[model samples]
Target chain A: MASYTERQAGSRLADYLSERAQVLSIALFFAICILFFSATTTTFLTTGNLLNVVRQAAPILIVAVAMTLVITTAGIDLSVGSLVALINALAAILMAAGLPWPVVVVLMLVAGGLIGGVQGWFISYQGIPAFIVTLAGLSILRGFALLLTEGYSIPIRDAAGFFWLGRGEVLGFPVPALLAILVAILGFIVMLHTQYGRQVVAVGSNMEAARRVGMPAKRVLASVYVVSGVASAIAGMLIAARLGSGSSNAAQGFELQVIAAVVLGGTSLMGGRASMTGTVLGTMTIAVIGNGLILMHISPFFTQIVTGTIILVAIWMNTRLFDRNWRFARRKPS
Target chain B: MMAAEAQATRGRGDAPLPPEPILRLRNIHKSFGSHEALRGVDLDIRPGECLGLIGDNAAGKSTLSKVISGTYIPDVGEIELNGRAVRFSTPSEARDLNIEMVYQDLSLCDHVDVVGNLFLGRELKRGPFLDQKRMLAQAETMLAALEIRIPRLTAKVEKLSGGQRQAIAIARAASFEPKILLMDEPTSALAVAEVEAVLGLINRVKARGVAVVLVTHRMQDLFRVCDRVAVMYEGTKVAERAIGETDLQELVDLIVGKGGH
Candidate 1:
């Protein structure tokens, strides 16, 4: 009887490393950044500074978590930044109009979802490329924000409860930071343990295969955008609450930072592979770099150059050195 | 002989018999714009039987299989499953009726792990979460039942070899306990020993009384596992023969449109 010879299982340690190559590399890079910053600046390692970093990274982290889902489905939402600006502007306008803060928050979230749904419909049902649809959204949404605010920042007043969401501390941790952490944990659970997460990966990996196997592929594709939109709304609200005002210019170039953070975390732009842990690390690393550069007495404008370089290098190593197929040593034939 | 009687009654308006066909296709016709992919094809699939479908490229073998699997709706035809006429508008409808197809490309998500792919669309979930522990245990048994050995069930599909991937695809389809399983060139990418394993797997599946339609160019494989064979030429079934009644030369001629029809 003809039989298939079973391949000998390789070393367990090797298998573990290869599978986690991207996450490990990013984590290592994150550690190195932390070490460099601490050694160079006496104040960089302080709890106050570290907490401040997380607090500042909060909005970007929130949106990056959602962007992870978007990228996992092989889709990108270029409109997130614009959507954030629009929501940010709208929240202040609504509050100034004397609408209750809670009601405004809910309305903004719903508005965000509706806007995202429209874009998702075009991409999924209408068969338009997400890049085109979201690009158009980026322009149109930001334009709407500019039109609404008339190129001016709107001040929010008498909304202490709403402000608390952004500025309050819980158990000695910043509220925004805690919320960001909670969002990250939820995103991680959804991506790893939930049926919806499986559907996203499956649809991203092979739409036809997922469809053949009776998955709601188009629906899954569309839902990720809605997720991104909602996350952006939250981030927008938090920003408004933090500074006690909103502007059409809020979160400018925010989409790039969110995308950079997601990609930096080892989520493939091609889709079907995602790591929430990597995204968290990636977001924190960027935040730390931006923060650490100032402490080192470096010019603030130079931060962009450094951030861009790190993105390029990290992705370079992601594709080359730490590929899932890369092995530390060759296995000898038994 | 039993094969002679079965052949004599085929396409002659049903035979009164002890073993009724599980699936019956009558006058199936499909077209793609200016191309007629399938023209008036009739076939029957009996339970516990393996039917070999052989033809050259563009011979409508794939189209016919797709029709059976509900990937494409036939322009005109009748599909009878368990004596009830049915029309399938989508693959899921056919899957709901326990019809499964393993395509030539294997149709697996490379980014998903082995256990996940095995239960791709029909995931075993508990309260909105994928029941990973349960799925892993079941996936292990599923592979073990097919005598397939994978180093780890958690390994991503992309990490697997061609033969291993093929085995996983076949395992995914067969383990689903479908009433009818259609395979399109499943063994084409497999190694020689892996081919044997697939053939052995087919026999095991056939023993479970599932109707299997295997479309392949491997003539020798037909003799090994198929109880009967059908030949197609230019979108029409030209001939059908029981395993004992046909030779490799006859099948080759039939596929190439050389034998006297």
Candidate 2:
């Protein structure tokens, strides 16, 4: 009988470690950051400061969850920051025009989805690259925000219920932070356990193979942007409610932060690999760096330089050091 | 054109009466731009029998298989599945009729785990969630049935050896319980032992009553598994022979267009 000699199965622990090398490395990096900050600044480890960090990181965390899905499909949404600004400004205008706050929130989310769908259509059905489509969206969406408010900040008045979503505490946790945690949990479940998540990964990994096997590859590709758009809308509304005002300047360069968080968490920019746990850690790490730097009486301008450097190093380690086949310890030849 | 017709008729006259063919291709033609990729070809695939399809490069062997697999719509002629004429506009439609093809590239997703790749398009789900446990169990059974051994079901496809990946692709296609299976150059890239394993797999599949079409340049493999052999040249099937009546030299000559009609 002809038989294929099976490869010697390595230790399951080794398999698990190699598979999660990137995530593990990111977690280590996050821990190191937390430790350094804790030691450098007395205020960094305080409960009040930690709560503040979560609150400030909420919007980026929420969007980073969606961006994880987008990047998993080997696609980038350059317009998320602009979309947040547009939604931020538009929500204030709708409330100013005397629309019910609840109604304005729903309308803004739908508008965001529609705009995202249009861009997705151009990218998926029209065969344009995602970077090109979203780059155009970045410019066009931000322009819309500027035009709607004439570059002026619009104040949202007398909506206590809407404000509660952004600032209210639930079980002693900040409302925005709680929402972000819930969103991250939902993202994790969808990515790991759902058929839709498998489709996204498959579409990213080998779209032609997915199509040949009867998957809705194009629809799956387009749907990620819609997810990102909806996430951006939620983040925008939260910001508007918290500040009691909307500005075209809200979340400037926010997309970069979200992408950086997702990448830092070990999601591949090339697509088909992602980690929600890593995304959460990445978001917190960046938030901590920014907060810790201020507590240490360092210049705010230096934060950007640190963030840029971290992104480069993280990606460098992701591709070079933590490649998919990387084993913690090489097995002896049997 | 006259020579092709004469050769096809001669080939048909020599064919033995057997069990009804699961799939029959008659006078099928396909064209790409001005190129006639398949010109007036005819073939039959019988249940529980392996049919070796051999030809030189660009001899319409791949095109004929693609037409049967519905990757290319035939410009003319008829496809009869179990005696009923059927038209396939898409590969999925052919798949719906229990026709499966394992392409030369294997068409397996590298990032997905073995079980996930096995259930790539038609995932088992319980209320929007993938039933991973069920899929894993089913994948184990599927691979075991084919006697293919892989150390891990959860390992990504990219982690497996070339032979293991080929086995997975073949196992996936075979597990569909298709009436007809088309394999295009399945052993072209395998090592010797892997080739032996694949050839054994073909025999097992034939025993299951599948109509197997094996397209290959390796003439020796044809004798090992195929019950009959068909030869194509310049978009037409020029000859067909029962395996016992032909040798490697005859097949090689037929493929290179040296066997006189």
Lowest summed-lDDT stretch of 10 residues in model 1 chain A?
Answer: A322-331
- Return the interface RMSD of the candidates, in order shown, one decimal each: 0.7, 1.3
Residues A115-225, model 1: lDDT tens digits: 989999999999999999999999999999999999999999999999998889998899999999999999999999999999999998999999899998999999999
Best by TM-score: 1
Worst 10 residues of 2 chain A by lDDT: A323-332
Model 1 TM-score, all chains together: 0.93
Q: TM-score for candidate 2, please give it.
A: 0.91
Instruction: For all candidates, state DockQ relative to the true structure.
Output: 0.79, 0.61
In candidate 2, the residue pairs with backbone N, CA or C atoms under 3 Å apart (3 or more residues apart, or in different chains) clash, namely none
- How accurate locally, in lDDT, is each candidate? 0.90, 0.88
| Candidate 1 segments exceeding 4 Å error | A1-8, A320-334, B1-18
Q: What is the TM-score of each predicted model, taking all chains together?
A: 0.93, 0.91
Best by DockQ: 1
